[model samples]
Target: MANLSLDSDELLLPRDVVAVDVPASWGGEVSHQLTFAGPLGPILALPGRRTRWLFLARWDTRPHTPPPDVRYWRDRVPAPTAHWVVRPGDALPLVSVIRCAIRTVRP
Candidate 1:
């Protein structure tokens, strides 16, 4: 993926959520991580392949809390998915929205 350049209309400050459109056959390893600031802290996404374009979700990490049940989301979210391990706080709603968007497109 390349830089996410956005037009004036697409720009959203603070929670600057951007979408990177990638081909379906992309299998290259995610050598670099693109992170954005969420409500809590830094949020990162590793996009995975889907039927057409790739999809991404903000994953939060909680050191004190038990690890998230990623196994369940792995299948549903698709391959090459990006996750941001963060404290369970404001990121929850963003993650939920990302998951819901992914679910809507999946078969």
Candidate 2:
């Protein structure tokens, strides 16, 4: 489990609640992993892919604090690999974030 510590009012989403779906081919199955960070949400990565996606959850309610910005994510997420944030819901944001991350990393 993640060593994430949250305040009493903050939402600590379960593995299922924040789960993200990715291409099966990327890892032989669609799996989710939580990246321990601030309010930036979960991180998704594939072994061969040069880019990773940072998913943003709605928290199902208003949070005591606002979510972190992209700069915060870029600075904290792992280096060498590119990262992008994907807001919860439909496939559009997922695809768009993937494309954007690819574009940013491909040079």
Candidate 3:
């Protein structure tokens, strides 16, 4: 959903592909701070293909420290709070696009 307007300008080409620039040559999670102008909240990318990234934190900036939330990402944990899957890409924009599409259809 996004605009479906193929304007090319609406394209979600992020500033970087992998989210964060780090020293992990082996390829790994990188945190990207996306301050959505709307209220969708901040996205933490444990990078992956498709909808792999989950909601890491709300817009409040209070760390998501719940054991369940942390456990879901325990397979790989680091200070960056971002993980990767398949390759590094922006996942939040994808989610936002989907949400926008759904809203258009539902409303």
- What lDDT, from 0 to 1, does candidate 1 have? 0.30
Question: How accurate locally, in lDDT, is each candidate?
Answer: 0.30, 0.30, 0.27
Point out where model 3 deviates above 4 Å. Answer: 1-38, 48-51, 58-76, 79-107
How would you encode candidate 1's per-residue C-alpha lDDT over 1-107 as one tens digit per residue? 12222233231212333222333332122111122223332233444333223223344443222112222232132224344333223333334443333333331
Residue-level lDDT of model 2, residues 1-107, one tens digit each, is 24322233232333323322333233211112221122234344422353333343322322232222222121123333322332323322232333233234332
By lDDT rank, best first, the candidates go 2, 1, 3
Residue 14: error of model 3 in Å? 26
**Which 10 consecutive positions of candidate 3 have the poorest summed lDDT?**
2-11
Judging by TM-score against the true structure, name the best candidate.
1
Question: Which regions of candidate 1 fall more than 4 Å away from where they truly are?
Answer: 1-93
Question: What value of lDDT does candidate 3 attain over all alpha carbons?
Answer: 0.27
* Model 1: colliding residue pairs: 46-82, 48-79, 48-80, 59-84, 60-85, 60-86, 61-85, 61-86
